[model samples]
Target: MGNTQIGHTDFMSKVRLTDRYVASVSPPPGGRIEIFDDNPLGAGLILRVSQTGRKSWVVRYRNEDGEQRRFSLGLYPDVSLAEARKRCIQARLAASDGVDPAGAKRRRISERRSRIIKTFNDLSLVYFAASECGEWKPRGKRKRPSTISGEKWLWTKHIKPSLGALPLEDVTPLDIKNLLRGLVDKGQDTSANRVRAQIRQMFNYAILEAEVATANPVARVPMMGEETPRDRVLRDEEIRLVWRALGDPGSLTSAQGARRANQRVYVSRPVALAIKLLLLTLQRRHEVAGMLRTELDLDQAIWAIPGSRTKNGRTTFVPLSPGAVVLIREAIRLADAGRDHPSAFVFPARWDRDKALTPASLTRALRDVSKALFLPSLTPHDLRRTAASHMASERLGISPLVIGRILNHTSEKGGAAAVTLSTYALHDFMPEKRSALIRWDKLLSEIVSTRL
Candidate 1:
């Protein structure tokens, strides 16, 4: 090993490169210099020192074609002398095997960059943005806001904590199975299924659109459990119990008529009115929870729900019964009383005046009430089912078609009937929906007023 001068201003020193020697070397005053490693393990490793005091490790090698090439190992301090030697040895071996190490490094970096979504969290952000921008709509229909909101809630509460940080390619079917298993163990079987479906769709999107994931891990994973269609129609006594619990906190007592001292449940007046409206109108929980002031016409007794908010992506005009109108007005009054300025939502969140009462909050409220009343587990959606069930009873004999219209259910029939109903039928069914709701209101009034 000897010293050699390449140019007038630059020189090369042949030295045994070590941590101590590399750290002791100083930069040249005018130009850069390369210190070649004399140690056998260093191979073609050299430490480049620039006039600005920057030091980096570079490995010089010859390709299969005998062309000279220089590949950077890394910067000094960040990449130690021993590590640089190790990388220098590997690079020299790769060059000896006729592979261009620099090109290979570039390809690896390019592939990583092509995988724009690195983690599940990154995939979720891109997926949600694409869905919002109409990139992933099925049959040219955008996802409903409530559906998106629910999915976001699920992601934040359940999915994100478990899988958000996991690399997209590393999420195995077993990971998804274990995630679903955890939910199932917590008695969230339906939620587990929903989470499974969401994960499946996300991975499908990753494969189809992002091109980052080669396969869907959730494709092989089965549903957590068999989800039976819920038919728990509330009996009249149960309905009365729910009504009393919503209206009177004192009525929320155990089956033995004893109020749990530690678990006194209180329903806010606006939430109570919203729950009452849910039963009276037979609308979805999110629909009732997100009732907007602009959607309601108290004079015309109509609630025109826009397509953006409805589950079926159709604007529905719900004919409000007198009872429904009364509930809405009461909720509005309470909302106004609680806020300095009028809120756009009929049922504004207790903490945030600008935002509507979330469907999750409604669910929680019903959960508390159910626990206090010692009632079988009841969701707010169950209230809608109770009304629809009662309307279709033998006593009322309300036509299923009318009930369907009142519920704003999409026509599920096929062929000419479906074609006519979906394509040709311009009838809003307002009159029929109104009549059915009025009859339901009358029946509900009786059920609530009757002493059990």
Candidate 2:
């Protein structure tokens, strides 16, 4: 080869390229210089050193049309001397095969840029947005906001830290297994299972809707732990303890007396009222947490939860007991007092009144106070179960069917009975539900009133 000059300077030199030689070369003062690699392995490779001291690898070749073209291999030190040579040989072979290597390189880059979801995080955003818009639900159905919120929480807390930055196609079953195993090892077996389910659903969404992933990595992965149906029912004594810990009116009076003697109230008033309402009404945590002022008619003692907010996509009318009514009134007062404007939700979030209190926040509050109270470790759902169990006991003598109605549970029965209940039984059972909850309130009053 011959030296090529540009801009009144010799800008080309021929040499056998080595890592040591490339590192020792200094940048030109004015114009860029190209160091041609004379080694047979890197016949058309050139090390382009600009006047700004930046170094990069370039491959010069002639296509089938006898057209000279240059393609950038990558920056030096990052794409090292040996890697540059390997890429140069590949580029030359492509050129000799009557292919325009520069065009091919540009096509590959353009294809990559055209992909909307490059990483797991990108895929998750698309999945969540689609879910919120009801695109993922069955015909005429919608996804629950709480379900979306819980999935997002799982992604942000558990999955995102491990796989969010990974390319969509790069997440393997082994990576998913390791993540679940880590959670299982920490004794979070249920959480591990939940994480696994969320990840599997996300990848399925990607495959069906986004067309990003070809296969679900979580498909072959087994469940990390056994999840039994939870049948936890807090005993009457435990219920009393929890009710007191929640700072009910009786508990608050005592807390205030303690505060006069320098004691602190750990439970917030709004959350306490919400939890009490959960036990009194036997409603789902999310449904109660997202209770809107418009959904209630205090005069008629009815709380009409819309189909949009429910799990089974059926509207439910819950009869609020006298106690539940009082609690709702107090929560509304607190909600109005906490913000500059009136909140639409009965249980408004503490930080942002425009939104309702999150179901996760309700769970967290119960978890923390339960631990502090040294009571049996229980969840908010356990409180609902406790109420249903006691109402079914010989003391209250409420039937399972009535309790199920109060809980707004969809009928799992099949055949004619299912059709009868689902299609014909259009009655809201307001009267029956009201009587059951009133009996429950009477029994609960006696239970919480007893001296522990």
Candidate 3:
């Protein structure tokens, strides 16, 4: 027991606080009761209990200005006796050094809140907006519509639903690892890699450009697996099968025959011709699918792909072969005959005439035709590879550089030849490219004519 000091007529009780003793004390009748912990008699802590049985731990000390201050430690049982005593000792040390622990704690809390990014979903939008406006540095160009659409697809499908509501700062590498593992577990390695790339880009923008986060949590996450490049070039026999299947549907079985028979709805006249043109011209699937009527000059046998539509952003003038010219003319004839077809696109969508046919639609038609022929499933890209492969072979006698130019491959070599081509030889290499493609087209024609 210790001598008690009355607080302006309110009764004050003093007792030694132990784990068992603190729990037994109750509040007195009228006002709140203050029971002192008598361990450090003079400058000790107080347990204040209200009439409603609410209990709180508080420390009484002198601050830097020598002013008596009573600081609330915390509620008891939630904060045990040992923890309260330890904190009180720390507060006493801070006061001796003329430091205000209460003010410091408040500033720390305020700083933490100011730096908080509430959620990933919210931060992702901010980052995407910054990217679109060219506000993020080292990224001077605004995202194209196609690029933006792709990112939105990834975000909507994978990112938003899972980690959208979680606090950005609280997203650890383990959280990212777990999310990616779930994607890989489903045998979607390519999709998992894409998700990882999207998340890494967003976090990088937040850390480096937006300055919202101190570190990028996605920096060290390994890719799910290495991707094997597709090398599916159609052989001579396969090419013959495709030609026969598209032209003669009666040669296939009942199931495959049904797919080819319902060509009006799924496989339109222009889309079927688009596949033949892809095999003849060996252009990109999108370029062939979204061909505009104005870009073609059938009189000169040229199909010009503008810089905006090309992957490399270069104006590519494809010299159409005799075989290609025949396909395009037929496509134009069919499109002109259809009253519902839009004049802007060579291959307009069947339902929506205003919009050009999507590459996916053209690809679906090609897959159906391939399936009908009972050939290995091949994409429009494989046709391009097939053409390029034949053109580059020694039998064709075409130079590798001319083949590369025909394919419009970006030059990665840092050498004199690359420098000379980029700086001096600004020509489209039309003469060499035309020669190589003509030889390739001839070979394809012989295969289709002889084998079928």
Candidate 4:
């Protein structure tokens, strides 16, 4: 009988690996073949052939714990014999240094996944939630929806597109500066400044609250450019023109009064009246636009602006003049007309009627009125300044302190004085403000009565 092998096991003598010898080897039936490499760098390297004739390179070593373990480097031909030898030496060296090679590889993979998950886009969302809940401010007052809306737009338009994908720690000031410079080069210096402020605020929140960033990337960057203060107070004639443009039918621009009214985005009558309230109250455009009918006390001639509505996040009670009262009543009439009950917003949006007027709509209306009357472009904020200037003049004899209260100018006086006024002197100065507003109303009446 022929000499026969009882099993498929074949053990080969150690030899230096070669491409030709590796290609000629085959596994015995129903068993694997083991071939050891003689090279010193591959002292533990073995060519493993399965019962199905599959080939792979593996390394066996005693770990620091004195436990035997096997690590697969790669398949033969795919790994190449020379590359397998290099990896086997590295693995042995790691085992000698008390490192678990398999555990180390897993740790590296985990760190890469962590970097992907901790990107700026992720951090910004966390920052936004904190800001929306009022955690970002010293007073802990919730931000207005419009203010938060602007921040979201800024992130979406500018921040998210440039650096959102990068990990938070990876963002550098140079990245921020380059973005700001691009905006400045396009004649958007003011916009760049605003974006810088918003981004800096977000980064600061990340550092202090989220603890995701070690430093604020934008903290060192200066504001893009000096913003020129606008001192464009309206003159008497311009005031008359504005009033007429809002009130008089003939004063409507050709585009506003024409047929196909739906196509034209002219200011509705209620919005015009809202502008009248702006001039009368000297309130910010957003404050007036977001007014609720419930906040007004027509009988008491007072409009109470809640703390959240004001820029300083303090509740303000504005005394309404007799003239202002009349305008408000007319606004109510317009709002309540053709409705079941009084609308929630004093200045309901023209499109929705249930919601308050948008800051954008108020701005657009003022723009149209300015264009229609051929007056210098003016804003609702200019009206606020004009009211303060007139009230503080010697002609009116209204004290600066009273004017400050009426305007809610807490930051007008800095340092100890501002702190004292805000903290200890919580008095509303209601009667003084009322007298000052009455005086202002008389002067405004005389100014608007003139037909220019």
TM-score to native of every candidate shown: 0.70, 0.70, 0.62, 0.63
* Model 2 residue 366 distance off true place after TM-score fit, in angstroms: 1.0
* Tens-digit lDDT track of model 2 for 1-452: 46778664465767998889999889987778899898999998999988888999999999998989999999989999999999999999988888888888666744563387899988888788889988876344567778888889999999999999999889999999999999999889999999998999898877765666679999899998777888999887888878877764333222222334323335678888888888999998999999999999999999999988988888888988999998899889877774577989998887887899998777877876665555556788998998999988899888888888888898878999988887766565678889999988888889899421
> Which is better, 1 or 4, measured by TM-score?
1
The stretch of ten residues in a row with the least summed lDDT in candidate 1 is: 253-262
Candidate 3: worst 10 consecutive residues by lDDT?
2-11
Per-prediction tally of clashes: 0, 0, 0, 0
Q: Could you give candidate 3's per-residue lDDT for residues 69-89 as a string of tens digits? A: 777889988977787888788
lDDT of each: 0.84, 0.84, 0.75, 0.79
**Clash total of candidate 1:** 0
> Model 3 residue 324 lDDT?
82
Worst 10 residues of 2 by lDDT: 249-258
Identify the superior model by TM-score, candidate 2 or candidate 4: 2
Screening candidate 1 with a backbone cut-off below 3 angstroms (N, C-alpha, C), the clashing residue pairs are none
